[model samples]
Target chain A: MKNNHPVDEEPPIEKPPFFNSWKGMYWLVLGNLAFMIALFYIITKIYE
Target chain B: MRPLDWIVLLGTIGFIVIYGIWKTRGSQDIEGYLKGDNSMKWWTIGLSIMATQASAITFLSTPGQAYEDGMRFVQFYFGLPIAMVIISVTVIPIFYKLNVYTAYEFLENRFDLKTRSLAALLFLVQRGLAAGITIYAPAIILSTMLGWSLTITNLVIGVVVIIYTMSGGSKAVSVTQKQQMAVMMGGMIIAGIMVVSYLPDNVGFGDAVAVAGKLGKMNVVDFNWDWKTSWDDRYNFWSGITGGLFLALSYFGTDQSQVARYLGGKSIGESRLGLLFNGLLKIPMQFMILFIGVMVFVFYQFNEPPVFFNEGTKSKLYATEHATELRTLEANYSSIFEEKKQAMQSLVSALKTEDEAAIAIAETKVENLNAAGKEVREEVKALITKAVPNAETKDTDYVFISFVMKYLPAGLVGLLLAVIFAAAMSSVASEMNALASTTVVDIYKRSINPNGSPMHYVNASKVLTIAWGIIAILFATFASMLDNLIQAVNIIGSIFYGTILGIFLVAFYFKRIKGNAVFFAAILAEVVVLYCFYFTEIAFLWFNVIGCVAVIVFGFILQTLIGKNEKELVKV
Candidate 1:
């Protein structure tokens, strides 16, 4: 149980690497886009 | 029925059990017991999450879904990757900053004790039920295929998972998951390839796909925007975006089973990467599994499958006075199916030869034959029910398993059975872990003994794991004749996820609302969601939407009514 402190004081941040890095965000978007494309291509090919 | 299959099953279990015990080493400390000392790497977290989500239903029924329906069930997960990105951005930072063990811990910090307890209570109920389905799913398939007693099968699945999970906690769950995933995927892909290879040499992959497509078993997407049509329902754009987002957010963000997996990550980046990896792989993995079902459908077109797939019911029907009638219906369906198969073959040949006229004729014949087959199957199904009054009449769950047992080679049959067990164990183990963590961290440590020794907490965690295991088995024994155990589990989650998500949303975004207001809103939201499920034509996924919106809308009304007197205390 955390000590019930006021909301104004910022909680201690663990700040693990790449918490909000551009590379992480890039890979996330890129990975999803690639997967979507692959799925679409397969479905379209099968239908065609 | 070969020695090879026995060797494979035994060897796989032996390795997983010994490896789990070796890695778990048993914990005496709460930190080690509940959180795994924050030592798991990104890959382990990734695999653990995948295993938890996969379950026996994913393996056993997914192919059947694809085989019976088509690849469109994959759309159910189209919203997952987007939801993962949303969680990584919004929920991850908040929970990590709080340094919480269970997701509910963050609820207490952001909201109040009552809100946390309510959310935890909801999770305990839903996951407790889902865990049983996960165990019961494979047990049903194995019992039906191998002719084992359902009770014995359920006990075997529960006991193996419990021993490993009790020994290792999160680490054991992760390690066994990594291995299980490798085997499960390898087994599934091999099974898919073998399906193609085992097809008549003249029927190549192209022909198999063509047959499945011609039969409407390859329909992967429905562009129609019909809210009323259950065909193009919740597994679509709107529910996928709104309701799916809410469910995924609450699950990964607040559910301890998932939260504990990431907390074991060596670093937050690793955790994020692990989640992101899941986002990338999950849809395709689901798609592939569903695609296998379509192939299985194609395989059955060439072969004369039973009018009803479940042998258990079929046998009872065979022994009854309706035996002649059922066999006659089956024989008629078989002949009609053969005619349709000829039509399908002609259609495939026409496509290759570019004969659109032949294609048209063949397509119409095939559709009519399929419609006719459904009528015959339904009659046989009715006879089965009349013969064995209380038997499971729905046979979609049996299609894929039936194919595997009748067609696959002996050694591969054993490996596939192992895959079923692995899938069941993976999901159940995670459920047991999550259930244990929620009980210990949210309820036990907070209320029962805040200052309890590490050894005492460790013991408590183990006991809770065993207790939840028994509860799940009991639920499995009585699981109603659900359409699909897979969908049933998700429906149960949908009923609760939105309200739980609403509470967490209030904690995260609605700062002015007190726990009291949100609590009332949550109960009202649940009632409203339940009403929608009962009274409206809305898909079950939309229940999440109804529930979330209800809480947010009703919460503000209650907050305004009450907060004026109390004065919104900025107690965060």
Candidate 2:
């Protein structure tokens, strides 16, 4: 099927510097957030 | 400020403005003026994005927010990374492919001209006022704290930003932001280190963190899931994820000030990398700023803090009929501070001894003392209100600056002041630049004089930049009426962002919905959001979610009705 969306034809798929793919980069970001939340939770528990 | 501080502040600002003008010289064409000729690399785009969002108020008020409310505010950005990932995948490529000047220009292609104009008008209204507030917020606080004339401070900030922004346009905003971000973060790091160093000799950084943690300043997340109370609560894990996600999507996806940053990028790849960079680093950057505030909180436990953070308001109370009462409150505050110091010392000692039971008891004592300190502070606030009813009584905005003036060494004071001014200029410059591009491209050239020459439109952009700069200055002059500068900016954005985001979402995902239905749905959704804001207890963050949802729901209904009418007309 022909792609109607012009942007989807040759999308920019250059990987970020460290990550192998964009998906990997996104996972790294989400993982970082999860780590931060866990660390904050631990801080809260230790203090409380 | 001392002579050294003045030189540091003025020299740093002078260098940035000149460099911006110099680097972006010869931007004769409209494309170069409006979009930096699509030449910016990812790092420049990233810092510009960060700089445009982190206004002086972020520097001035965020730490104070952390100092007073604890680190839970960091949770507010939990959804930002998610928003970044979504925008990178969806929004950036589309904008890059269209080669549009403003985000609104894409709306015209996707929907219709009126839809584009409506979105542009909404952005102008919010961002225009926000531009002024960016200048006014720091000007008011700095003038009062430093004994400078408020008018001079506002003009210095407004006119400097206007000159470079008008001269070089979008590239100027992007270029100067790199320098501005350096000064901002560097000064903050120095201030953070000084805060820890100023702690009592017996206490270390770990001890201070323990002290802050014990006193509830280390609270970075709250997963409490009570819907009954959650809607009214501003920041929590759930609200941050859901509400914050919506807000970030709207702001980064649709807001031209931000969109313009990456639209100036070299390619879709550069823009996407820039946004992903922001997503990854923004939370840590905010956490660091907030942690600096927590350190300041710990520092105040060892030393004496002012009864009222705003010296101007405190002085006004000193001269009024409530002078004696103010004096008594000051004494009471002093007594509470002494007791709090002793309690903190005991808490520190308990931590040193590693005695869990004693640590718990000491923590309670410190918490009680902190509560008592707050009560005395509230009494002081009441006295200030009684003395100067029209004055801004909220002191959290003043907390970080007050600490800087009192404790930081001489040259660092000037450096930090420069940080505030740089932050203010970086944000205001981006705003004025974005406002000008939208006015000239989306509204003026497109609507009024479609036949104007390229140079004519370019000059029109410059004229509009100056015009919007003036409007922002005038607005800043009258911005003192609002309390809590940072929240005021966000609330104004919230009131408008959801509807804008909804319009874009429908345009992107709902091919069946035509321009007419989505346009009216946007207007109706805005009214409903405003009603919720004025008449309900729904937290400001949720307004983003509500406004977006309302628009989508209304769009589907209106489109179905319109579709049925078209079918009936065919039968007739």
Candidate 3:
């Protein structure tokens, strides 16, 4: 059956240079956030 | 400012405006004018999104915030990356698939016309006012500090933004933002470097950081949890992650100004990449800006700092009945500054010695001296209020700019001023573009003239752009009455964003809820949000969470009631 919905037609997903997939890119972003939070926590402790 | 400063400032701003208009000269059709020919790359889109969000107030108020309140303000962005990822995974694909001109247009598809109009109207109200603030924030501060005409400053920013934005529309906004972002970041980075170099010969960067940490200026995170007090604490880890998440999601997902940025991308991938890039870099960019403010705090430790940062207000105090009281406060302030300076030096020396015991004692002394200095500053503020009842005595907004003008070299001063103007113009241009697009697409074309020719809609968009620009300028001219320009913008957004986000979230996720239920629920939710804002001490960020959840709960209840009514009628 042909789906008429444009969303289901899925546009081609180009992989970012460093990440293997969009999911990988998202994980990298989340990882970066975690790292930043940890680093900020350390900075707070060191300075406090 | 010197001749070199004027030349740099004017040359930079002039080049950006002319280049933008020239590059986007042929946007004759509605789609071309409103959506930028759908040709923006990931980097351009990313930078444009960032520039649109980082208004002049962000540049002016954030550093000042750090100077006064420490780096806890950085926590506010902790949820932004999460918001970005979620939007990329869900909202971007849907928006691209629908190919809607405005985010609100998607509401009409998922729900009903009334729902779409309601969300669009909320956005227009919040963003239209925000556009004015974007221009007014820098204008008020710059005019007072530089002794420029306030009217002229407002007109200069509004007119420059209107010209390119009205002429070339969204393409012009996106194209010019690339250059504006470059100038803003470049100017700020240079200012940061110059501030450190201008410090006393003995004070290196490491010493400055240590001194700032000792004085509590380097406080970047706070994990304390007290539910009773949490709602009032503006910038803590908990409020930031939860409330910040809701705010960011609503902002990036439902706000037309942001949706319009990604909507102009060439493809969904490009748009998603653009948003993800912003998520990756925004926090670090904010950290750098706040760190520069901390550097300014350190710079003042050695030098005699102003008792109040706003010199314009200070000059006014000289001619007032309380001038004698002001002089006494100034004398007390000077004495405290000397004591604080000595204590700071003692702390710096202790830090260098690597003796923990000495460092601890010096830290206590420095903190006490700093508190004394703050008490004198408070007295100055009280005297200013007495001298001029209507004056804005919170001078933190003037801290960084005052430092730049009085201390930086002449040409760099001009460049930094250009940075402020560029940030203001970039945000204002995007806002005008988005506001016009929404007014034309979601309101005018969708309802008033569904069959209007493409050319006619294009012209209408241009006219609406001019109209919004003028309205913004008028609003900015009178915006001086508002307190803390940055907070004012955010408070405005918070009041409306939650209800709007709730409506969209229902349409997206709650398939069982019908249009009537969600539309009425959004209205009720907005009223509740406003009630909380005006009556309670709940932090503004929590409004997003509250408003969103209220809509969902209300939607389900309304739907069930309607279902009961229908069943009863059938039995009858």
Candidate 4:
């Protein structure tokens, strides 16, 4: 919980959970967006 | 309000205010006061960011919007996740590297003092006005519905936010936001459950949703687009992805209110994770709120909805000379509801039977009756205009609150009211904190008194927080008399955001363009957007795109024209 790094220095970048790199995290977000859009599209067709 | 409702409302808001002050009581230095001493974790940053953006009008108007227009508004947030990715990859590191308090501090690092001051001033101008509306927009609606004085409602929101923000500054804002977000989401979820429970026993949850869909209120997506029509459409998929992206980028990227949220994070990873958390959850949160609206719409089908949702406005019609006419219209509305109620039953039965032809016939009957009901409502609005003269005729904003007052139990009514108050306080607190930090860091310290001690600056920040809070309260008080004031604040934000984003984009990516070129380009770009606002029929949302692109384009051209002098100057 203790933060040793000051604001001026590069704070240590930690690995994101479930992903080795930040790229996977970015894709997770984008992929979630795409999936939601598709799901919404399906809902539109079903209800409309 | 019942005594139980009053107790719940007061207890909820009082707990948040007292907890905010007490939890952050240790904050005394400038770093802690302005940026929470870089002590916030990912969840704190994420919730603070979401809470800051989710204003009182969001809680107050969004469901009403869904009741009238369906769920297409959720698309407006489509670009936010992408923007989060972009800012995380670029802007966060630069800001962290420079150790800036306000976002404009980075502009000075990247370009010149003039450019920094310019961005900061534009922010102050627009956000200062918007902070007032943040309090006023909800105050007007709450006061109207509750029959309380508008000034009292505004003061309650403004003064509570100021008390905590002034006492503990950024830490208080972030700490309290976690609770505020909980209240907002919890209150809405409970409201959603109550609405569903209020549906007729004959109608199951699936049946209610089907009814909503058949009536076209389940429209959650629209991919159809053409250049001519789509440019003006604000909430379609394409505009949402592109235009919404630019708007979010400007908002979360450059807007001090938002920047302050993540800038309080303990590390780069925490800030990045915080934004990504929002990107992933913000849409679903909006969808949940809009879905509650859809359910409210369906509930109205089996039950009688008020002919006009704003009972306050409708009541004004009774004292006027057109009172007789209004009574007749109400009669017509009641009869139409009877017919529509029967038609809706048939539609539900037909859907259950899975008979296409029967379904079509029932759907048509329901649609026709719905149209008739709509006509009666429109006539009532017209009558209200003629009869009350100055009454606001649009009732979409009143739909959800009216339902809560009319249907929800006493304790839940207080909880819902707490939800709105929590939302307003959360947003106002962030704006007050951000406004104070920007004034102190970007303007006061840099220009007026650079030699002040850290404690002196913290005191100055607390004073400025109170000052901005008072200004916002005053603005909200007077702004209620103006028409379309929310739209006015939004226009001001859009006009400035694009140019600010452009300057930041130039700073981050267009490194070849120096400070003077981009600064002038930003001014010129803002003028072009202003011209579009005043002269062209272009939608205001596009001003963000135009202003952003114009800055980069003009920055290039200006740099090319003055390359020799700039290069020489740089060498010197």
Worst 10 contiguous positions by lDDT, candidate 2 chain B:
B21-30
Clashing pairs in 3: none
Off by over 4 Å in 2: A1-13
Kindly list the per-residue Cα lDDT of model 3 for residues B464-556, writing each as its tens digit. Answer: 999999999999988765778889999999999899889988988999999999999999999999999999999899999999999999999
Ranking by lDDT: 2, 4, 3, 1
The TM-score, computed over Cα atoms with residue i paired to residue i, of candidate 3 is 0.97
Interface RMSD (one decimal) of model 1: 8.4
Cα lDDT, model 2, residue B262: 95
Query: What docking class should model 4 receive?
Result: acceptable
Q: DockQ for each of the predicted structures, in order?
A: 0.09, 0.22, 0.25, 0.39
Q: What is the DockQ score of candidate 3, to 2 decimals?
A: 0.25
> Judged by lDDT relative to the true structure, which candidate is superior, 2 or 3?
2
- Candidate 2 lDDT, B284-342, residue by residue in tens: 99999999999998899999999889998888888888999988888988998898888
Q: Model 2 residue B34 lDDT? A: 90
Give each model a TM-score. Answer: 0.93, 0.97, 0.97, 0.96
Across the candidates, what are chain A's individual TM-scores? 0.52, 0.67, 0.66, 0.72
TM-score chain B for all models. 0.96, 0.99, 0.98, 0.97
